[model samples]
Target: MRLMDSSEAITIKDVRSARRRLEGSARVTPLLEDPHLNAIAGRRVLVKAECLQRTGAFKFRGAWSALTALGEGARERGVITYSSGNHAQGIAHAAEELGIPATIVMPDDAPALKLANTRGYGAEVVLYDRAGGQSREEIGNRLAEARGLTPVLPYDEPLVIAGQGTAGLEIAGQARAMGVTKAEVLVCCGGGGLSAGMAVALAAEAPGLRVRTVEPAGFDDTARSLAAGERLGNEPGASSICDAILTPMPGELTFPILSRLAGPGLAVTDDEVLRTMGLAFQRLKLVTEPGGAVALAAALFHGAELADGPVVALISGGNVDTAMFRRALDMLDAAEPGAA
Candidate 1:
C-alpha cells in the first residue's frame, strides 16, 4: 500500500465546495468580543470559538467535509486514519455520521479521554508505541488497503483544508458585522491545516487583514519550514505540552496557499500557552486546551504592533483535562503578569 500525498492545493473552489458539503453538519462556532482579554491586550480582541465546535474542536469541519466529499463507492468502503488525539475523535465522529466504519491508529500514550471518545464513536482503535510511533501515513495506508478502506488524511487534503477554512470565513463575516475593519487574525498551528485554511479564507474574504500563525516554540517545524522557504520536518521529533501542535511539518496540499496567504509564523512557549489557557478560563469563562491557547498567547504577549486595534484570535480547541486546567490556573495565578 502506498501512502498518498495531500491534494494539489487549497483554492476558492475547494473552500466553496467544502462549505456546501458541511453545511448541515459542522457547527458555526461564534466570533465574539472578549472584552476582558481585550482590555489586557489593550487591543480589541475577538475570539472565534472553535472550542465549542462539535467534538469540542475544529477538526470536525475538515473531517466531515472531507468524508462527505467522498464518492458513494468510497463511503461504502469505510475509512482509515491515524491521529494522536483531536483528529482521531473527529474522523471517528464524522465517519459515524456518514455511516462509514472507521479504524484509527493512535499512540499508546494518546490522551485517554480522546481515545475513549474515538472508540465510543465506534472506531476500531489500534494503539502503537508512543516513543516509537511509526509513520502514521504508512500504517493508515496499509490498514486502508488491507480492509479496502478509504484513507482520510487529517490535514493534507484539499477538502479538509477547505472545510477548515470555513472557520476563517465565519470570522471574516462576523468580524465585519461587528465593525472590525483592520484585524490581524491569529490561529494555532499543527501540520498547518487550520492556519493554512484560515489564511486562504481570510486572504480571500478579508484581503486587507494579516493572518499570522502561532505554534508551540520547540515544536514549531511549520514556522521553521516557512522561514527557510522549504519543506522541513521535525527530524528528531516533537516534545511539547501542547500535544496537538506537535506535528512534524506542513502539509503538501496546504503549503502553496499558506505561503501565499499566511504572512509569517510565530512561536510561543508551553508555559505561555498554559498561562493563556488559564487566562481564557478565568476571564472568558471558557475552557481552552493548551493547543488552542497559542493564538491568544501570541496576541497578549507578542502582538505589540497590533496591540491597538481589532485583533481576531482563533481559539482552536477546548479539550483539556480537569486536573490540568486547575493546575494551569493555579500556576498562572502564581505568575506575575510583569516581573523582573
Candidate 2:
C-alpha cells in the first residue's frame, strides 16, 4: 500500500471524528496522578492509563476506526492483520463487535496471555516463527489476497493514525483540566503510530505540549530515524524484552508527522522497564506491560532531560503474561540491595 503524505493524510478533524465514532464503545480512560512519581521526576507526573482500554491496549481505537470506516462490501470480505498481541486483540475485538470475520497473524512466542486473549476474541490465529525467519507482513498480505480480505495495517495508514490521535486529544484536555499548560508527553513507540498520531493531535490541540517517543534500547528505530531526519531500520539482530513495541522501523505514514512535530526520542533499558512496572504496581496500583511502561520508565529515569513543569506518560497496554509480570517483579527485587 502507498503511504499518504503527512500533510494531507490525517488531521485533528479526523481525530475528533474518530473520538465521536468511539463515543460509546471506547472508554475515556482516566489520567492518573501519583505523588511518588512526581517526586522521582521532580515534576508533576500524569499517567494516561490506556492500559485500561478495551482489549487491554490503545490499539483498539485505531482498529475500531479503521474497521468502522470500511464500506459494507469490504466489511463482508472480512479483515486480516498482523500484531505481536495488542493490535491483534484490538482488531479481533473490533471485528467481532462489527460482525465481521477477522484473522490475526501473530508471533508464535508472543506472550501466552496475549495469544489466549486474541483467540478469545474469536479471531483465527495464524502463528509465525520469529526464530525461523518468518515474516508476518508477507503472511498477512498473502492471506488477505487469497481470502479477499482487507488488510488493517497496525500503524501505517491514515485512518489508523487518526484513530490513535484521539488518545492525544484526551491527554490534551485532561492535562489542561489539571492546570497544565505546558508539558512533555511521552508515548510508547512501536512502529510510531501512537507517537506520530499524538504529535499531530498535540500540534493542533495543545501547541504548548511537546511529544516524545519512548522505546526499548536496542529497538530504537524511531529514535534513530528522528535524529537522522530520515526513516531508519533497526539492526537485523535487534531484540528486547519489550516485545510489544519491537517493530523493524517507523511506519512510512507515521515518520513524516513525527519528524516534523515530535521532540527527541527516549530509550530505556529492560531493567528500567521492569523497575517501572514494579513501581506502577506498588505506587500507581496499575498493571502495565513492559512495552507500555517504557514511557513511564523514561519519565522516571530520564525526566531531567525532558521538558519542565509536568510530564504525561502513556501506559499503552496491560496484556503482559503472568510469568512475565512475576519475572519483572523478581528483577525489581534483585535490584534492591536489602530485598529478599
Candidate 3:
C-alpha cells in the first residue's frame, strides 16, 4: 500500500476529528509533570503517558480512528491487520467495542502479554515465524486474502497515520492547558505513522515547536532515511534491545513530514534505553518498554538541545517481557559505580 504524501496527506484537523469521534472511548492520558525527571535532566520534562492509553499504548488512538472511519459495509466485512503486538490489541479492542469481528496476524516473537490481550478482546489470532523468512506483510496479506477480511495496516495507510496523529494532537491540547505553547516533542517512531501524524498535528498547532523522534541505536532507519531523503529499509536481523523499533524504513507519508516537522530521529543505546526505562518507573511511576524509553533516553543523555523541553516524551508502550523487564530494572540497579 502507498503511504500518504506529506503535501497531500490529511491534516491534523482530520486527526482531531478522529479523536472527537473516539470521544470518551480512548483515554486522554495524563500529561505528567515529572519533578524527578526534571531534576535529573536539569530541564523541564513532561511525559504524555500514552502507556496509560487503552491497550496500554497509543495504538488505541489509531486503531479506534481507523475502525470508526470505516463505513457500515466495511465494518460488516470485519477487519484484519498485522502487528508486533500492541496494534493487534488496539485493533481488536476497537473492533470488539464497535461490535465488529477482528483478526490479527502477529509475530510469534511478539510479546506474550500483548498476544493474550488481543485474544482477550475476542479477535482471532494467527501467528507466524519471524525466522521463517516469510515477511510479516506477506503473512498478513495472505491471511486477509484467504479469509476475505479487510486488512488494516499497522502504520502504512493514510487513515491509519491520520488516526495515530491524534495522540500528538491531544498532546498539543494538553501542552496548551498546562500553560505551554511549545517545546520539543519526542515521539517514539518505528515505521513513522505516529511520528508523522504528530509532526503534522504539532506543526500546524504549535508552529515553532520541534517534534523530534527517537529510535533504537542499531535500528536507526528513521534517522538515516531523513538524512538520505529516501525510504531506507532495515538490515536483515538488525537486533535491538528495544524490539519495537526494529523497522527498517520510515513510511512514505511519514518521511517528508518527519524531516520537515521533526529535527531528526535521534538514536539511543540499549543501555540508555534500560536506564530510561528504570528512571521512568522510579520517577514517572510509569511502565515503559525499551522502545518507549528511547525518547526519555535522549532527554537524559542529550539534554538541553532536545528541548528546554517542557518536553513530552511520548512513552510509547508498556508491554515488555517479564524477564526483560526485570533485566531493565537490574540494569538500573547496576547503573552506578557498584552492584546492588
Candidate number of the best lDDT: 2
Ranking by TM-score: 2, 1, 3
Query: How much is 302 displaced in model 3, in angstroms?
Result: 1.8
* TM-score, cand. 2: 0.96
TM-score of each: 0.93, 0.96, 0.93
Residue-wise C-alpha lDDT for candidate 2, range 1-340, written one tens digit per residue: 2223445677888888888888899989999999878887788889999999998899999999888888888888898989999999999999999999999999999999999999998999999998798999899889988998888889987778888999999988999999986999999999988888888899999998889999999899999999999998988886788989999899888998899999999999998899899888878888999999999999998976797678899996889888889987887677746331
Q: Which stretches of candidate 2 lie over 4 Å from their true place?
A: 1-8, 335-340
The per-residue C-alpha lDDT of model 2 at residue 308 equals 67
Off by over 4 Å in 1: 1-7, 235-238, 305-308, 336-340
Q: Write the per-residue lDDT of candidate 3 for residues 1-340, one digit (tens) a residue.
A: 2223335766777877877887889887888887767777777777888889888888888888888877787788788988888889899999999999998888898878888989999999988887676587887777667766777777777777777888877788888888878688888888888888888888887775678878887788888788787878777766887766677688766687787777867888888888888888877788888887898888777774564546777887888888878988898887765321
How much is the lDDT of residue 183 in candidate 1? Answer: 77
Q: Output the number of the TM-score-best candidate.
A: 2
lDDT of 1 by residue, 18-55 (tens): 88888888888888676667777778888888889998
C-alpha positional error of residue 199 in candidate 2 after TM-score superposition, expressed in Å: 1.1
Clashing pairs in 3: 234-248
